[model samples]
Target chain A: MTVLLDVRGLNVTIGGKPVCEQLDLTIEANQSWALLGRNGAGKTTLVHQLAGLRPVEAGRIRINGHDLTELSPKARAREIGVLLQHSSRGFGASVFETVLSGRHPHLSTMAWENAEDHAIAKRAIARLGLDALSERSLDTLSGGELRRVELARLLAQETSLCLLDEPMNHLDLAYQASSLDVLYQTYVAPSRAMLMVLHDPNLAYRACDHWLILLGDGHWRAGPRDSVADPALLSLTYGHPIERIDSTHGPVFMPRTSLEGAPDNHDAAD
Target chain B: MPTAQHKRILVLALFAGLVSLWLATSTGGTAIPATEVLTHLLSNDGSTHDEIVDRLRLPRALSAFAVGGLLALAGAFMQVLLRNPLGDPYILGISGGASAAVLGVMLLGLPAFWHTPGALVGALFSTLLVFGLSRGAGDWRSERLLLTGVVIAAGWSALISFVLSISPPVRLPGMLFWLMGDLGDADRPLLPLLLMSLGLAIGLLRARDLNLAARGLTQAASLGVNTARLRLELYFLGALLTAAAVATAGAVGFIGLIVPHMVRRLGGTDHRILLPAAALLGGALLVLADTAARSVISPMQLPVGVLTALLGVPTFLFLLHRRVRT
Candidate 1:
């Protein structure tokens, strides 16, 4: 299996605090990794670094055998697509126009969108079930609708690697499921890789084949789901006791609740 | 897609612009008949009507049109660069800087044409200052840039007041008239017209990326916009357009702030269409305003900028109210 993304000796700091130090990660084709972290644990920061939006303090990152630093922003965008957490609205562009802008990297600077570009954008919008809202201005869309519109843009980018930051944000349960399903269908092919920041453990567990847990204070663990999804590791990573419930389909994690005055699981374990 | 409707609006704006240009040229303090003005233009006759039409009114009308077009184009680019509806050339302090410099030149009793170079220098200085201040510690957010510009604009306004207060009484009226954006002394219109054309071309070429930029920096960059480069280009282009307009006609207001918004409301948001439409409509609107300014009181002319504000404020408010109601 050829590795599509390689990160070696990575160090990232935000606001003078070290978030990731000496981290190494390698993603092979057809692998979807879920990045799980607490608030302020730098999950979004790491994703930004991967997307080349933020500079790494010390590290080497290569996507598709090309050093990330060597590629211009346009070139980098051709191979790696990112769905940001939030984008400002009120640009007064139609949803179709906004989505079509994703084809910018593929076209020359002065070239308008050709037939293929329009077709791809249309298809992506349809995939996200936003065909009805194609002509609507971005300012009029609800939060969930806007998220889906952004998802369509991400899809239209047609990059081999996708870095999604909280991709399920502002989505209802049905939309969350449908969007994840679309992402899975589109990105789970050979020669493709996806890394997403997800808050829901069960959703991540079910949708992703690998787990990357970021413990606070620049500590992290990464491995295949079977090896890294242990209850103890999950519990320690979140700083809360997590109980795993096994269903016929898969395991679900719930926060461990204790009666008042009772010793917590961490204390009992210690 | 909807090219027919957009094309119709463009045609209508062009026709209206031609009519306004004719009206501005023919109906001034002298009030030559339209047919006589057209015959003089067509026949190249050396009559007094021909002299007035060719030498005085033509240049002034074209200057007004060029200045208005440059300002509106600059405003459109600024709005996209800052991602704010209120973004305009004046908001970036370019106009204030130019006004202060021109006032300084007047205070020194320099030749009339000296104010152009003075305004240009002041504009460049302010652009660099804002650009440098916004780049502190490698933080280049648009909101920070806008705040820096607004604060600097306020500072320039204070300096303009200082210059106005201490100026010799003899130069006060000229200074006041210039500050009110009068085009009476706008002798050279060629440079402004050329710069306006160049600005419009650049706007059209980068319209797609600008559309993406209107969303936000990260969104534009994520879609391969080379956002840093785009932002730099937009900043320089916007400053150049503002400088050209300010140099041509001192500190014209409201046209820059209002024309682009009006274009977007009437036409659409695609910068490709929005930009050309803005140029034509801005030119036409300014020509109409200048005509009203000169003819409304016959020989006693009002400053074109004052008329624009008087005309624009109510129209803008009406548009806002209607937009909200809808």
Candidate 2:
């Protein structure tokens, strides 16, 4: 399989807290990977480092055959599309205009959007079901709607590797399924790959074929979903009791939050 | 960011500007026929109106127009840079620096030619100081830049007052008039007009990138804009335009602060359209204000800055009220 993203010895630290030490990761084409961790696991920081927004402390990242740092900003943008967790807006423009801005890396600074560019933006908007809101101002949209707009922009970007930090933010169950389905369908080729940060293990299990978990304090595990999505490893990482139930559809991972999960353990009562 | 309706409004604004220029030239000091003003504008008829049209009224009116254009164009960029709808060309205290330097030069009994260059130097110095000092340990956020500029502006204001208080009484009248934005010595509009045109061109060329910049710098960078360069463009381009306008007529009020808001309120938010619309609207507003200033008290003019504020405040309020109502 062709490797799309190669990371070697990535030393990620934020505020003197080591996230991972000498982390090596390789994402091949046609793979969907989930980056799983609890809060403060440096998941966002790691994604940002990979997105080229944050500096990589001591590591090398290669996209396709070229060094990530050596690529021009425009070239890198064409290779890696990112969906950040939170977006800040100074002033609002229309949804269509916002989506069209996704094509910035493709055009020269002064070039106007041509027919093909507009068509791509339009298709993205349609895929994300944002056609009705295309002409509406951004400030007028709700949280869920805005997330869809951002997803549409990412779709319009059309990059080979998508680093999506919490792509499920503010999404309802219906949108979560439809949007991820659309995204996976669009990138279901040997030349494209996706890595997303998801909070729910079940969601990650369903959406991704591979799992990478941050165990905190410079430790991590990476492998196929079944190898790394172990109940004991997740319970240790989250500092809680977790139980994996073999459902009719698939195994579902759940935390032991209620009394029924351990009926005899009165010591764990809230 | 743009639509056909925007283009229609641009054409309408251009038409309004022409009529305003005519009104400014024809109705000051002495009432020349409006048709005669048009005739002289079209061709040199060598008539009696030639002295007023070619010499007296035309120069001053064009000076007001260009200064207005410079301020509003700079204002358009400032709003995006600071991410504030109320952002003004003078918000960073460029006018305060210019005023202090120009007043200092006048106090020393320097030749009139020194005022423009002195103002330019002082404005640039203030810009550099804010830029250099506000760049602390982290990102050069707008909040840091704005704070540094406002504080330095206060210092410049203090210096201006000290200069005014200690100036020989004989030079006080000229200093005061200039401070209140006099166009008496603005007989040459060539430089300011050129500066406004150049600024307008750059604003248009980078209009699309400006749309992204308006959203936020991080987002703009993610979209592949060289944000460091764009940030520099915002700072220096704004300072250059403002310094030129202030050099012509010392710190005209209301035009820089209000015209961009007015244009945006009128639905010219796209920088491609907003930049040019602001240039036209701002120019015409100042021309009419200057005309009213000279003619309202006839023979004794109120400061053009005072007239701009008095006229602009009500129009802006009305527009805002209309938006709220609808």
Candidate 3:
């Protein structure tokens, strides 16, 4: 399989704070990877770097063997579709128009709504079960529906690689399943791959073909799903007492919910 | 939902345009009979009525329409590009910059308004200041650009006030008159340049890149838009549009800011439709406003800017209320 993206010695710093340092990762075609991390673990930062939205403090990121640093943003977008951490504001646009914006990377500066663009956008909206709401305002949709619409927008981009930040956040169980299912069934097939930021271990275990768990202290591990085992590893990965058990739904991590409402104890995780 | 509503609003806008046209030409300082007005325009005889109809009122009326359309188009373009509802040439200090240059020429003992290259200098200086503060080659942001424009505009306004305070009394009335704004004293020779600038602005807007641009810079770039290059082009085009409008009518206020918003309310947010609709509606609105200003105090001309401000503030508030209520 061809490698779609390669990140080597990646380091990113924002506002004088180190977010990512000496991080190395690679994504191959036909692969599905779940990026698991706690809040403030640089997951969004990593995805942004891959999408070429952020400048690399130091390192190389290549998409489809083309060096990202060398490629223009427009060119990079043609290969990778990125869904932001949250839905955008100020648009007040309809679902169709929003989805149609995804085709902007493929069309020329003078081209209007050609048949091909509409066909692709329609397919994407159908995949998300948003046909009924295609003409509806995006603002009026539920959180889950909005996420699905945004996902449909990414699918309309028709890129080889998908970079999603917290794709499952704020989604109900049904929507979480449906959203990921649409992505996997339609886009992330044998030829393309996806890298998604996730919070729930069970969701990650169920949906991902590979796993990347970033520890709270900046270190991370990556490999096949089987490598994500070992309670000790998961505990250290989260910097807290995490209990991983085999449930009917597969692997579920039960963090010490006891820590909820507890006084600040930053060093205890060490 | 928005699409259907947008279609309906577009229809309403067309109707409004027709109504505005009739109202604007009818209610003016010298209310000539409709039949006589038409006869004067169509006739070749150099009659006094013909001169008043063709040479005086017609040019002024047309210029008002053109300037209004140009400013609104510019404002709409800026708002979309910057992704801010508040984005306009005046809000961002581009107008202040233009005013400052005009002020300099007016009070600094330069030759009369006839010698002032005020619009271009002012707009360019302000736009350059905005460009410098917002981003370098690779770091542009809408918020940053807006903030920088605000700061620059405030500073320039202060400088203008100081200069005005110290200038000789002889120059004071001209300065005040220029600042208050009027379409009645337009230089007919400048009309061609105004038309060219408006045409150029419309051309730049027709590019597919502008549609992507409305979606924010990162997304636009990702979609293959040359962000920096487009920004430079848009900034220049926006400045040109403002300069043309200022040159034509001497700082007519609020037409640029309000017309775009009003059009968006009726025509949806697609720049393709939005710009044209704004152009028509803006031109119509300003003409009507000017007519109202003249008629309300007949035989004595009102500063068109004062009427625009009075009408604009209330209309804008009503639009805001409608947006919220809807």
Give TM-scores of the second chain, every candidate: 0.88, 0.89, 0.82
Give a tens-digit lDDT track for model 2, residues A9-97.
Answer: 99999989988889889999999999998899999888878887777789899999888888887888899988889764445677888
Model 1, range A32-88, lDDT digits (tens) per residue? 999998889999889989888876679899999999988988899998999988856
Better of 1 and 2 by lDDT: 1
Clashing pairs in 3: A74-B224
User: Quick one: best TM-score, which candidate?
Assistant: 1
Give the per-residue lDDT digits (tens) of candidate 1, residues B15-70: 87899889988987787998787777777778889999888998899998999899
Q: State the C-alpha lDDT per candidate.
A: 0.84, 0.83, 0.74
Q: Which ten residues in a row have the lowest lDDT in candidate 1 chain A?
A: A85-94
Model 2 bad stretches (over 4 Å): A258-270, B45-48, B108-117, B128-152, B311-326
| TM-score of each predicted structure versus truth | 0.92, 0.90, 0.85
DockQ of 3: 0.35
Residue B242, candidate 3: Cα error in Å is: 2.5
Ranking by lDDT: 1, 2, 3
User: TM-score of chain A, model 1?
Assistant: 0.94
